[model samples]
Target: MVFQCQRDSWARQFTTQVVSCCPAELQTEVSGKKATLQGFHVILEDTILFPEGGGQPDDRGFISDIPVLRVTRQGPDALHFVQKPLEPGSEVQLTVDWDRRFDHMQHETQLFIPGQHLITAIADQMFGFKTTSWELGRQRSTIELDTPTMTAEQVVALEQSVNKKIQERIPVVVTEFSAGDPEAETVRSRGLPDDHTGPIRTINIEGIDANMCCGTHVSNLSDLQVIKLLGTEKGKKNKTNLIFLAGNRVLKTLERCHGTEKALTSLLKCGAEEHVEAVKRLQNSMKLLHKNNLSLLRDLAVMTAQSFKSNQPFPPHRKDGDSEFMNIIANEIGTEETLMFLSTGDEKAAGLFLLAGPSAMVETMGPRVAELLEGKGAGKRDRYQGKATRMSKRAEVQALLREFTSHQSTEE
Candidate 1:
């Protein structure tokens, strides 16, 4: 069934022909100064977007300038949210952001939890602890244990036993066959559907853990860099979350920490070990200096206000470029009014602003002021600040402020 989009601005309705062009139709919403966009919700007749199912993350993508934050399947439909508005009925192309998707796919494919390890360990202990459980987590495989509790001593012993196997460079083979005997050469792992019939897949890490699994895995045990056991905690009744990292990732993380330490030491002009203390001392000193500066600025503002009131031959000097002094005065006074403050210096860009005040100036004409400025900003009833990037003429800002004040009075 094909549906055409129609516009009803009152209904906040916008239409596009994206549904016919691609398998997915995307929607977007944009707002504010930083222009932080969030939305690219795809509504497709049918889609490839996977639901948050089986401990896997959703996909992300983009359309035009809009970034798709998340893609999820609702029943039979897929919804995509974007950062900005897209034209209705326009055939816009869509692309899935693959970096995130690939990482998620890799994680899903390599969930190497420790069900088989625990079971085999139990069997081995009963039969004289002859078999070994390799450190599967070291190879980029996420491993979990099903047992409720294991002591620190036991974990250390297990790790030692597993690493010994890695030094042996064992073969990890995957195969499929009919399920029959319990004491066969292979065993069934988890992740199989409930309604299974014949060809069950089995993973055999020779002289180590062997179980059935349908997930993707690397061929050799040596491909795993090194399984460094981070920590472990007891789970519901008889399960344990064995937290660890695999292979080159752990090494990379350690290297990153070392690099950060060196960079921070150089930045702080201190030795690596003294960096933290130096930073803390510098922070304390800066805070004290800032307080002193603020006190001086407040005294100057009071004196300046008095001069303005008394007409003490103080010329309205154009301050530094970007009018940092004007901003300072606004912050200090904390007043909301249609106040016109100007700063002039040999600067390049004319940064024009339609600054709103705490009083009536912002309440009525803030939005209209922003629209006139050819820039975008929004604020509450008390205060607002918007800029005119293109308004290079110094007189234009004064003109807009005057126009806004005049229009505001007439509207009132």
Candidate 2:
């Protein structure tokens, strides 16, 4: 049946009789009464819900106070998916979600979201540049301009030009045409959809733009309040996505951005205007401090390694040739002559750096240490280095290394 939504974009209610409703699923209510509980498609004599179309979302609403989950187009009818079923031939009240409907209507304004319908359309008419595509967000919209060599200066110029037109507060005009009308085909913004036939709706923004469209829109450019271009992002096909804000969204974005700037200023200990430079300076200071600390750790490691050099035993070839052992510095914890266990990390986790006088000791104990950490270690030049997960087992690792060295000494 012909629907009110198709003709009157602002229709909010309908008192209709249910032609048919099939329950997609059934459930028992608290009164043990069977309830379809939504997911069922219902057909009414007529509806005010605009089904999903023209890249816009479907109308969400209530029928008989039950939620309308979704609305989709089927041939010539609008199908409303509802939570509960209504008896066929019964009368019901259908109400549209006015807030959502008006929000969509706000976005459809030529002054709010730039497209082939606003000053962008004028750009095409005046120059070779135009919007190739557009996207609408909750509080923002993006229109991809078709110029490949467009500059930042040019984008600013375009924004100023659009804003100038908006300040004029031009009235928007709607024109209709019969099927396959030559005038409808002449619209600059977009072509007809696949199934569009008969009457064609063309939107005109005074002398600026004229385009084929089905979405609802504002009556005047002034209702948009103002248009604020956020910036541009590189788009597909070398186009540029022009981000913008309008009306209530412009104020909302400004409020949100101010809050973010305040947070950054506090974190960097700087004024709002100086936040970026202050953050950069703080990061540089942190990098310098990290480099200095690493240098200190390396110097300490070298000193520790040198003390172990004299305590370790000489290779078999060196000992066989001379029959003497190198002397190691003695300490309460360990001396390198037999073994030295060095480690790093904190109470929760650590790593092991083991140096042994005899190669045999490193080969035998390294695997056991690795298993304890569920990790791997490698040995080279009498030093075994690897990460250990069981940091609290530092004493256990020392005991194992000691036991291995003692066994090798006994064999000798």
Give me the candidate number with maximum lDDT.
Answer: 2
For residues 1-412, could you state the per-residue lDDT of candidate 2 as single tens digits? 3356655666788888898897664243657775545368888888888777665667889998988877877766667887777799999998989877766665666532236667567556656676666777777787778866666777687678777877898887767788767777787644655665457776788877776666666677776677777778888888877787777777778899999998997777789989878878989999999777666545544454465455533211111111011112112224344565555545346544344444566666667777765556787655566756665766676677667767767987
lDDT of 1 by residue, 22-91 (tens): 2334333446333344344556433333433334455555554556666554443445655455554565
* Cα misplacement distance, residue 49 of candidate 1 (Å): 22
lDDT of 2: 0.66
TM-score of each: 0.48, 0.67
lDDT of each: 0.49, 0.66
* CA lDDT, candidate 1, residue 263: 92
**Which pairs clash (backbone N, Cα, C closer than 3 Å) in model 2?**
38-83, 310-327, 311-328, 311-337
How large an RMSD does model 2 have? 9.8
lDDT of 1 at 148: 60
